[model samples]
Structures are given as structure tokens and as C-alpha cells.
Target: MKRFHVHVVVPRLDESVRFYSSMFGAEPSVLKDDYAKWMLEDPRMNFAISARGGEVGVNHLGFQVDSDEELTALREQVVAGSVVVQDQPGAQCCYANSNKYWAQDPAGVPWETYHTLGGIPMFGADSRESAAPDAGGACCAPVTSIPAVIEKKVGCC
Candidate 1:
């Protein structure tokens, strides 16, 4: 089985948590100082919010699969195309351990396909900041294969 996922960044954690809890009609399944996640079975959506972001808005979108086979299939599908894909096995993030693959839409919207392995005590394993600012600081962080922004130089004639 797969669940549709959406992650967002909020400026105010307390206010956002209250709002989302009320909106979803339930409290988050996982709550941390900087992150909160709601595994909404009723709506079949994995909604998450985080405060450790550079901006306050939609962070990224993703799908969470139930098994390694599903995750493998998902990664294969993404890598089959020309778009670069970064695969992270046993990556720790969001107070959980997961195996996730990441890629970006043509518009450069980061999209992830992951399978949760189990829960962890901390947010993530990264001691350093996320090079991918759009990607939060965690194992969910984009890896080396991630594309760099291209700057087209304009010359005044």
C-alpha cells in the first residue's frame, strides 16, 4: 500500500499544530520540537509540518510505501527517466528511520518516495546543515546526485 504525502514548513509551530490538528480532526501521530506528522488513515494522507525550514510554505511532496519491494519499484520508476534520482537506504529523519529515494519534478519541486522502517529517538542523523535548502536538514536531505541550479549569464550589448 502507498500513502500520499505532503510536507510543509510553518513559521509558528504551536499555532500551526493546533490549526492542523483541528483541521484534520486529530492530533499528530509524531510530534517533535521542530516537526509534527499526522498519519491520517481516514483521509489516507500523510501530512507533516516542520519549523526547521528557511521559508514558511509547502516544503515538498512524497509517497510512503509499505514495503521494500514497493520502494524499489518506486525508485526504479523514477530512475528509468532522465531525471537524476538519489537513493538513501536506512536514512533517519523526522523522528523515524526510513529508506527513501528522492527526485525533482521538472519545475524543481522536490519529490520523495520512501518506506518507513521504524521510529527513532531523534529528528535525524545529519550533524551538518542540508545543502539542499528546499530539502530540510535530515536524512531526507537530497544527496550528491542532486542537480545544482544553473545560472544563465546575461551580457548587456
Candidate 2:
């Protein structure tokens, strides 16, 4: 199974959490000082919010898979469609360790497909050798791959 993922950067964490909690009708499954996540089964989505001091809007969109096989298949499909892909095995991001592939759409929105391995204490640490020099301390997608305009508008988790 796969869950749709959406990470958004908000100006205020508390206000956003309250709003989203009311909208979803549930409290966050995981809440931290600067981050919150709701593993929603009703809509089958992983919706997360953060106040990481970047542009205030959608940060990134992704799919979370259940198994390595599903992740590989998703990667293969992306590759088969002629999209360039960046593989980050054991990526530590959003307080979790995951094996993920990052890609961008034609309009420059980043899309990540990953399978979570486990949890971590910190939010994320970008350790990719090819990570952008000016990532602005953001995690998930490689900022170098995103357009300059879009990069400035998205926040890191």
C-alpha cells in the first residue's frame, strides 16, 4: 500500500496545527516543536507541517510506500517515463530514516517517493554528496534540481 504525502511550510506552527487538526478532525500522530504530522487513514495520506523558516507554502509532495519492492517499482516507473531521478538510500529527513527517490515535475515542483525505515530524533540531515550548495538547510528534494523561483518558495522539513 502507498500513502499520499504532503508537506507544507507555515508561518506559525501552532495556528496551522490547530487549523489542520480541526479540518482533519484528529490530532497529529507525531508532533514536535517545529513539526507535526498526521498519518491519516481516512484519506490515506501523510500530511505534515513545519515552520522551518523558508517560503511559506507547500514544501514538497510525495508518496510513501510500504515496502522496498514497491519503492523500486515506483522508481522504475519514473525512470521508464524518462524522468531523471536521484536516489537517496537511508536518507534521514522529517524525523525518519527512509530510502527515497527525488524528482521534479515539468513545472519544477519536487516529488519524492520513499519507503520509511524508522524514526529519528532530529528533523533531517542532508548527507547527499550531490546536495545543492545553497539548499538553505532544507531536506527532502535536492534544491539544485528545482528551479530558482520554486526553490525560494518551498520550505524544508
Candidate 3:
């Protein structure tokens, strides 16, 4: 089944954990120093978080595959298109020992199709520092009302 997965970066791990636990009646399955994850079967999503700037929100949105073969097939499919692939076929990400296929749409929004081969020992897995970052260290920067001062025009706002 196709499920929607979201990874959010939160400022306070404890606060978010408590809130989500209370709200969803579910606790995080994987907890790390700066990260937490809740893999829900009912809703069917791999919701995750990381510690940074006390700002809470989504890191990326993507799908998880059942196997490495599926991931490889996705990579080929993505490569067949005009999308630029990164992390290639054999790269570890999301604290999971896995292979992933990454590409950006025309507007530069990342689309990841991944298969988790195994889990990593660490909990707070920061994808920004580990993998792709936009030019500098800007991963999910907010759009400014002042369009004149915007460095990159992603049409987010």
C-alpha cells in the first residue's frame, strides 16, 4: 500500500513527543538524542522529527518501499525522466541503512523514493547535514514577503 510519510524538525523533542503522544495516543517507536520517529500502521506513515532551532515542522515528504529491488526500480524510473537523481542507488539516509533515490521537481522540491534495509543505532538523524542541502545549509527556509530580498525564488510563498 502507498502511504504518506512526513519528517518534521522540532525545537523541543520532549514537548513534541508529549504532544503527539497525547494527541495521537501513540508514542514514538524510535527515540534518539535529537530525533524521534513514530511508524503508525493505521495511518501508515513514517512520521519523524529532528532537533534544530526550536522550530518544528516537516523535513521532507516521500514514500517508503518494501525492498531494495523496488528502490532500484524507482531510481531507474526517476532517471528515465528529466529529474536529477542524487544519493544515487546505494546511499544511507534517515538513520536507516538503506538505498534511496532522490530527485527534485521543476520547482526544486525534493521527491524521495526509498527502501529501508536496516535501522541505524542513532535516533536523531539529520538529513540536511548528512545528505542534500540547498547551496548553503538552507533546507526548509521560509519564504519572505519581501520578494526583492529573496535569494532563491522557489515560489513557495
- The best candidate in terms of TM-score: 2
Rank candidates, TM-score, best first: 2, 1, 3
TM-score of each: 0.85, 0.87, 0.69
lDDT-superior candidate, 2 or 3: 2
TM-score of 1: 0.85
What residue runs in model 3 are displaced by over 4 Å at the alpha carbon?
Answer: 53-56, 88-90, 123-157
Off by over 4 Å in 2: 127-136, 143-157
What total of clashing residue pairs does each candidate reach?
0, 0, 1
| Clash count in backbone of candidate 3 | 1
What is the C-alpha local distance difference test score of each model? Answer: 0.72, 0.79, 0.55
Model 3 residue 144 lDDT score:
30
The candidate that achieves the highest lDDT relative to the unseen native structure: 2
Candidate 1: tens digits of C-alpha lDDT, residues 32-120 = 88889999998798998888755567777889999999999878877787778877787777777788877778876777788898887
